[model samples]
Structure formats: structure tokens, C-alpha cells
Target: MYKNGLKRIIDFICSLCALIILSPVLIILIVFGTIFMGGNPFFTQPRPGKNEKIFNLVKFRTMDNRKNKNGELLPDEVRLNQYGRFLRNTSLDELPELINILKGDMAVIGPRPQLVRDMVFMTDEQRKRHTVRPGLSGLAQVNGRNVITWEDKLKWDLKYIENITFLGDVSLILQTIGKVFKRADINREGTASDIDFGVYLLGKGEVSREEYNRKQAEAKELLKRR
Candidate 1:
């Protein structure tokens, strides 16, 4: 009952309330983010949602667009300034995702949506993470977030999918709030972006380097055709 219907209802109500209640904070972040990041305050990117459907995921922009001499964007560490770090640590950067949840592109608790390009690299079991709506926070996030390996995160994601319940969702939500208050696992050592799941699979020999390169090439080709 909850999974098919009530869960979405609760998600809609909660997200709407959150947006209303957090409007001031959102406004402050938008103004500051625009001033510091020097672009739109919100970041929007295509992410794979339930059933591998793509949606534009939104979040507060927390990094500046710093380009190198050749005009390629600089690395995450170089672009993430002090103000950006504060937003990330406080998880204020995720505030805009409430809008996503309200729009039915995300849930309050479920597997986190992954980059659309990463979908081609996932194993059958890993692909199961998209069987449900993606989340703003999830079992994997509350468990270890960027601190855990991608395999471990996928395990948690699958576990959550298998055992999703109204009570379970509430529990995960509470745990997420606690973790955010403690500012736990905001980033992995030495970088703002965690280890890429595709790169990790290649490093562990789960996928050959040639396969990785081919998948990336295919994705790029598809993007050009689009």
C-alpha cells in the first residue's frame, strides 16, 4: 500500500512542507551561491530514476566554474571554495532536491539517483537500485555515504529496496537527520567528489579497462547524436 501509493503521498506532503519551511534558508543559499559560484544557484543534471528513467536532478550549486587554459573545467577540489565547502558540510547544498521530490522525480528515502552515463556500467544486481524512485537520502547514505566502497553502497541500496516499508522509511529519515546534524561523511579524503563507481569497478578488475573505455566512448557518442 505504502510503496505504490501512500509513500508518494507522504513524499509530496513532506517535500512541500519542507520547501515552505525552508524558504528563507533556500533564498539565502541561492543569493550566496550565485555570488560565490558565479552561475545559476541550482545545479541540474540528468540522473537515472526509477526504472532507469532519466530526470533532471536539482541541487544547490556548491562549486565555482573554474576552467583551465584549454577551457576544460578544473577538478572538483580546485573549484570547491570555502563557502562551497560549508554548504556541502552542512548539506545545505541538497536543499533544492525537495523540489525534485515534490515533482515526483525522487523520494524522501530510497536509493540515490546515479549519473545517467553510469547506468551502462552497472551489473544486473546493481541495476536493481533503480527499481524504486531515487532519494534525497537513503540507507546507503545513512550507512557510510562516501566512506564506504561502491559495492557496499549497492548492497545497502538493494537491501533497502527489498525491505522498503513506511516504518523503514521513517527510520532512515530520522537516521539521516542525525547524520546531517553531526555532519558525518560529508566527503572522502582529499576530494569533494567521491571515487567514481565505474573507476572503482575497473580498479578491482570487475571490469576490464577496455570495457570501461568502450562504455565511456559509447556514452559520448550517444550524447553527440542527441
Candidate 2:
């Protein structure tokens, strides 16, 4: 009962209240973002949501759009400034997702949405994570977050899906808050961001370079539908 219905109703109410309560913090971040991030404070990306549906996921911008002399964007490590790290470490970068939650594009808790390219590479069993709305903080998040391997992340996600309940979600939420307060598990082992699924697979020799490129083309074509 809670998994199929009560979850969304509670998610809506909680996200609405969270937005109302956190408005001041949001405004402060916006001002600081203008000064430090150079302009826009929000980042939007097309992500696969429930049932692999595409939606733009919103979050506070944690990387500047700095470009090299050639006019192309610089590497991600170069663009992720100190302010960005602070936002990421404290999990404040996720504040804007309350809007996504309120808008019904996400849930307060579920599997974190991955890139469209990542979606295309997923096996049908792994793709089951999309059976519910993506989330702001999830089992994978609280369980080791970006520090965990891609396989472990999906493993936890499936575990959560197998047993979503009101009490279970509440427990995860509490664990998330504690983890955030401790500033734990923000970035992966050696990278500033989580590793992309496609890249991970290619690195592990699970897919050939040719297959990777082909699937990327497939993902791009699907993305064009929006």
C-alpha cells in the first residue's frame, strides 16, 4: 500500500514543505552563485525518470562553464571550483531538487537518476530502477554514495526497490540527513564526480569501443525526441 500509493502522496507533501522552509537558504545560494558561479545558479540536465521517461533534473550549479582558449568547455575538474566543492560536500547543491520533487518529476527518495546514455547501456534487470520516480537521496546515496562502485550502486537500488515501505523510506531519509551533516561520501574514490556507466563499462572491457560509440549514437537519437 505504501509503496504504490502512500509514497507519492507523502513525497508531494514533504517536498512542498521543504521548499517553503528552505526558501531563504535557496535565495542566499542564488546570490552567492551569481557572484561565484558567474551567472546562472541552477543546472538542468535531461535524465531518465520513471519508466525511462525523460525529464530535466534541476540542481544548483556546482561547476562553472569555463572554457579553454579554443572556446570549448574546459575539463570538469578545472571547472569545479572551490565554491562548487563546498556545495557538493555539504549536499546543498541538491536543494533545488525539491522543486523537481514537488513537480512530480522526482521523489523524495528512490534511485538517483542517471544519464540517458547510462539508461541505454543498462540491462533490463538494472533498468528496473526506473519503475519508480528518481530521487534526491536514495539507498545508493546513503550506502556509500559516489564512493561506491557503479555495480554496488545498482545493487543497493535493486535492494531498495524490493522492499520500499513507509518505515524504510523514513529510515533512509534519516540516514541521509546524518550522512549530510557529517559531509560523508560526497565524491567518488579519486574523482570529483561519479563515474559514468558507459565509461565504467568501457574501462572494464565489458563493451568494445565500437559498441560504446554505437550505443552513444542510439542514446543521442533517443534524446532528440524531446
Candidate 3:
């Protein structure tokens, strides 16, 4: 009872206070993101929320609109300019998600939302992460962020979903504060700070025992190196 009721109270109070306190920073981010990205200050994308519901997740635009040969977009690292990189490194890009929390599309603390494409790839057990509303800062984000593999992040998300509580959320939120200050796991080596779920999926094989084995082996090696 306390878990359900207290959690909602915490969400309401904290979100309201945060929005008020951070309004100035939020406005600045909006203007900067818009000017940098050319039109849309906000980047909106469909992400799976609680119970697999689709919601528009919003973030500040942190990448420029520079494309490459054949008019296709260049890699994120290439397009991420200095200002964009600053927003990402400080996690200022996530400021727009306060609107999501206000609209009931997210919670202040829960498993971070996954893209719809990535959600489609979730295993049956992994899908349990969707049982609660997504969050701006989750267990996975605070623990490892881009430093951890997708599989490990998913496992952490699932574990958090299974053990969610008022105290757990508070603890996770506090820990996230520490991570932000420390700027841990901001990016992977040789890659941009942000991840494109679509591109990541395309590189993996979804079928055949041999394909599965190969992917698993590669994932293991990456994990060992990390």
C-alpha cells in the first residue's frame, strides 16, 4: 500500500517542485537546442512506457543536421557539435522529459523508456521492465548508462522493476545525482554518447542458432573489455 500510494505522492511533489525550480534552466535549454538544431528545440520519439504503452519521449536536440554521402545522415559522433556535446555530457538534454512526467507518460524514477524498435526486441522476461512507467533516471542509467551493454542494462531494468519501492526510488534518484556530478559513463569509446537503437539492432542477427551464438560471443567479448 505504501509502495503504491507513497510513490505517487513523491512523484507529484517532486515533479512539481522540480519543474518550478528548474524552469529557468529549462527555458535556456529550449532556446539553445532550437537554435542549434535549426527548427525543433525538442526531439520527440516514440518510446514504450508502462505496460508497453507508446508515448512521445522528449529531449533537447543535441546533434546537428549534417548528412553524409548519398544524403544519408552521418554518424552521431560526427554531427554532435561542441554545444551538443555539452548538453549530452551534462545530461541537460534530458530536461525536456519533465513534460513527460507531468503528462503521466513517465515517472520521476523507474526504468528508462526504450525505443519502440528496441522494445520489439525485448525477451518475454525482459518485457517486465514495462510494468512500471518509464523514468528520466533509472537504475540502469545511474548504474552504468552507456558504459554497460544493452543486455546488462535490460537486466538491471528488469531487476529494478521487480524490486521497486519508495525507498528504492529515492536511493536511485540520489545516486543519479552523484553520477551526473561525476559524469560517469557518458559515452562508449569510439562512439557518441547517445545510442541509436535502430542501428544497433540492424547489426545483430535475430535468428538461427549460429547467429545467436555469434552475437552472444561478441557481446561477451565486449563485456569483458568494458
TM per candidate: 0.95, 0.98, 0.84
lDDT of 1 by residue, 76-192 (tens): 889989998899999989989999999999999999998756777878989999999999999999999988878888889999999789999999999999999999987777767
Error of 1 at 226 (Å): 7.7
Which whole-number lDDT from 0 to 100 does residue 153 have in model 1?
87
lDDT of each: 0.88, 0.92, 0.79
Error of 1 at 149 (Å): 0.6
Show the colliding residue pairs in model 1. none
Winner of 1 and 2 under TM-score: 2
lDDT of 1 at 215: 82
Q: How accurate is candidate 3 locally (lDDT)?
A: 0.79
Query: What C-alpha RMSD separates each model from the true structure?
Result: 1.5, 0.8, 7.0
Over 45-112, each residue of candidate 3 has an lDDT whose tens digit, in order, gives 77778887777899888888888778988877788988898988888888888888878888888888
User: Which prediction has the highest lDDT against the true structure?
Assistant: 2
lDDT of 2 by residue, 43-150 (tens): 999999998889999889999999989999988889999999899989999999998999899999999999999988888999999999999989999999988888
Show model 2 residue runs off by greater than 4 Å.
Answer: none
